[model samples]
Target: MTIQEIVDKILAYHPDIGDRRTCDVIVGADPNRECTGILISIAPTVPIIRKAIEIGANFIFVHEPTFFSGYDDECEWLEGNDVYEEKLALLVDNGITVYRDHDHIHAHRPDGIFHYMMKHLGWLEYLKPQARGWEVVLPPTRLGDLIAHVKERMGLEHIRYIGDPDAIVS
Candidate 1:
């Protein structure tokens, strides 16, 4: 299927976002091009783009902006910038289409990002619906241990925290 078709299919699963403008858009290459493979990521950094090329992926589905801006479509300020130009050139030359699924994914029922994050952290069962948002109630544990758990679950080398490591938390 074409990149645009795949993007449309994803949007179809989201709740009606009304007529308000959204950040979800094609930020690079041609959406009409047939997709050979897809690379799903949090952001389309230069390294990620290179990895996509190496994997022979013609389409990249990202949850964040491709350009260094809140709205990826606004590129007037990025003109003449070396980094922006290089990234754009990489996408264009490699024929890699980059699509951001930001707003729509957040608008999805149960919230697409948070739901998956909770599931990945094994905290979905601890989720409690609050008036304004959801909360996760974990068993009491030391802050250091919780941080280590998060790092292991997310496969991160390091993480930053601003509290006493020995402090108990839930």
Candidate 2:
């Protein structure tokens, strides 16, 4: 598939929310070019771009901005910056098409990040689908135990909560 075809598929699946068309765009390279491989990532940093080139992937579906700015036309700050130019050059020279999927991915009914987290933590069975996203009404348990459960399940070493350790959460 070409980059444009992949982008069209994403839009068909997720669409765009209301007036927020800030994301879901091809930020770099020629979208019509056929893709060799696709790399999906949360960020399109220089290292990630280089890694994509190394892996022979010509399409990068990034969840964040390719350029330094969120606003497309606000790249004046990046003008003449060596790092910015180098990154742009890499994408152009390597024929890498960079598409940003920030808003649409989150706006999708299931919420991609939430779905992944729930599935990864074995909590999908407890998921309660809502208009916005999935929510789980966990049973009452001590805050400390809840924290521990989250830490263990999420593979997190540190967690912060806004309640007493002894407090029960429903």
Candidate 3:
């Protein structure tokens, strides 16, 4: 399928849900170009782009921006910079098309990122979906223990918590 078709399908599947606008856009290549394969990534770094090319993938659906900024605007100061040129060249040379999926993914039903994380970390059973994130009432556990549980479950090496350690969450 063509990159345009993929973009259309993706937008249809996860259309702008609320007041937020989607950042999804074909950042590189012609939308009509036929796709060899697709790559999904949180961020399309130089290495990721290279790997995609090596694997014959021409389309990337990224969660973040291809350019340095959040809005994916080209940095003016970096126009003549080597890093920017190399990164841009890599995508252009390989005929890769990048589409950012940030806004829609976050606005998705049950919140895509949160739901995925909770499901993967075995915390789905405890998730009580709120407006933005899950809300849960624990069984009178200490704050430190609760934090430790989350850290261990999420495979986090470090975490920063707000509020008192001895304070009850629920």
Best by TM-score: 1
Instruction: Give per-residue CA lDDT, model 3, range 52-143, as digits (tens).
Output: 99899999888888877777654676788788788878888879988888788777777888778777766677766454576644467678
Error of 2 at 70 (Å): 2.3
**What C-alpha lDDT do the candidate models reach, one value each?**
0.89, 0.81, 0.79
Report the Cα lDDT for residue 149, model 2. 85
Question: Which lDDT value does model 3 have at 95?
Answer: 95
Error of 3 at 119 (Å): 1.1
Least well predicted 10-residue stretch by lDDT in candidate 2: 126-135
Q: lDDT value for candidate 3?
A: 0.79
**The 10-residue segment with the lowest total lDDT in model 3:** 129-138
Off by over 4 Å in 3: 17-21, 129-131, 134-170
**In every candidate, how many clashes are there?**
0, 0, 0
TM per model?
0.93, 0.77, 0.77
Point to the candidate with the largest lDDT.
1
**What's the TM for model 3?**
0.77
**Best-to-worst ranking by TM-score:** 1, 2, 3
Question: RMSD of candidate 2 to the true fold?
Answer: 3.0
- Please write out the lDDT profile of model 1 over residues 73-114, one tens digit for every residue: 889998999999999999999999999989887886578888
